[model samples]
Target: MMTANPYSFRKVALGDLDLLMAWQSSPHVQKWWGAQEPYTAADLADPRVARWIVSYDARPFGFMQDYSVHGWENHHFAHLPKGARGIDQFIGDPDMIGVGHGPAFIRTRLQALFDAGAPVIATDPHPDNAQAIAAYKKLGFEPSGPAQETRWGLILPMLLRP
Candidate 1:
């Protein structure tokens, strides 16, 4: 079995636009991420979302985003604490897929959020994205309830509280 790899996150910057586009286009990501339209400059500029490049041992290999769940107008998750946050991520490098890095990376993000005073952390993955859901579960996330239909798509709600 692959061991958990040390990882860090760097804020996504202007120079990373092209890289983000490419990763979103990768079939490995596209199949599960299901992003049909490319992300626009405005999307990247959204202040409500925090995006990061996932680096393993100082080498960039994936992407992650965290945002306040209450930031979305009338979001279903607004019932959570005011400090509740949500995260989504993907390993962009095919070579890194199926490795043991994802759970470690997610744990790091969760710790950062909790340290920053987020009382609740949540994630929603497509029901069919078993790999991603399993990763979240490994980190102590529980299926909060049934599937939710949102503009992005149908997502299986998962939650963690610290």
Candidate 2:
């Protein structure tokens, strides 16, 4: 039988801004994440967003953020149920980018959300981000529908019901 992933998550704090900024601007993360502008303190402090630092074997390696779908302004998923949430993430460590770590981290994060009463979790990745789409699918996410336009850009909506 498959074993549970051991990734751990820590609540992001202001001190992490510099680290977040570095990852946000890194070529590996930026290529797919499209960090148009530096993330501001206000953005990290948004009440609607829950940001976390993802670590493996006690080593920080990535970042993840989730928001209440129904609480976000002009959110395409505003129609979802109250417990619905949306997540965005990326592995910042180039050495850890690819090696079957993404799906595990995502699955672990989803489990935490589900345990916290979120029945559904959603993500929107740029249509061209096939690798991200595939990784999300491996975590049991399915395309919710056609592409949608958002302030960030065009993305294919995917959702997972836990």
Candidate 3:
């Protein structure tokens, strides 16, 4: 279970909030991450967010959110169709960048999602976020070939299972 190959997701704690926020707001991360409005401590305090801690090799490495489960539609990915799960994640720990865990981590989660009955998994990111776009492509995510000229509308499709 501690192996990097079979990634497991864990619930996050209040103690991890600050570290998570720091990563969310960091300039280094802004490129790969979406520009969500600053999440107040009170926001993180929300129980509905259902945050999770991401690990690789038994080491806690980053964070992930399940917005497709719930949230405001226009802003976050809550607009994703029912039965679709939206995921937002990051390598919160500074030392973990470029460690080569992201693609596999996403792959594992997508597999888990598909196994759970999600027929389609969608991700929306800034079109200019080249590295992330590249990474997703490498993982078999293909564009729906639609763009809205906004950060969204850049739809990437993932075949969760079968």
Residue by residue across 1-162, what tens digits does model 3's lDDT show?
A: 563474678877667766676777877676666565665668666754546788876788777775454454454444555676666677777787786777878777778778888767766656676766777787777665554454354444332322
**Model 2 local distance difference test score:** 0.88
Tens digits of lDDT, candidate 1, 1-162: 996647888889878978888988999999978775756668778988999999998989999999988888887687898889999999988899897888988899899999999999989999888988889889999999999898778999999988
Higher-TM-score candidate among 2 and 3? 2
Q: After superposition, how far is residue 118 of candidate 2 from its true place, in Å?
A: 0.9
lDDT (CA) for every model shown? 0.88, 0.88, 0.66
Better of 1 and 3 by TM-score: 1
- The TM-scores of all predictions, comma-separated, are 0.91, 0.92, 0.73
The digit string of per-residue lDDT tens for model 2 on 6-115 reads 79999898898888888888898988877657667798788888999999998999999999887757888887888899999999888998898888888888988999
**Model 2 / residue 16 / CA error / Å:** 1.1
**On lDDT, who's better, 1 or 3?**
1
Error of 1 at 29 (Å): 0.5
- Please give the range of 10 consecutive residues that has the lowest summed lDDT in model 3: 153-162
Task: Flag the better candidate by lDDT, 2 or 3.
Answer: 2
By descending TM-score, how would the candidates be arranged? 2, 1, 3
Candidate 3 Cα errors over 4 Å, as ranges: 1-6, 32-50, 69-81, 149-162
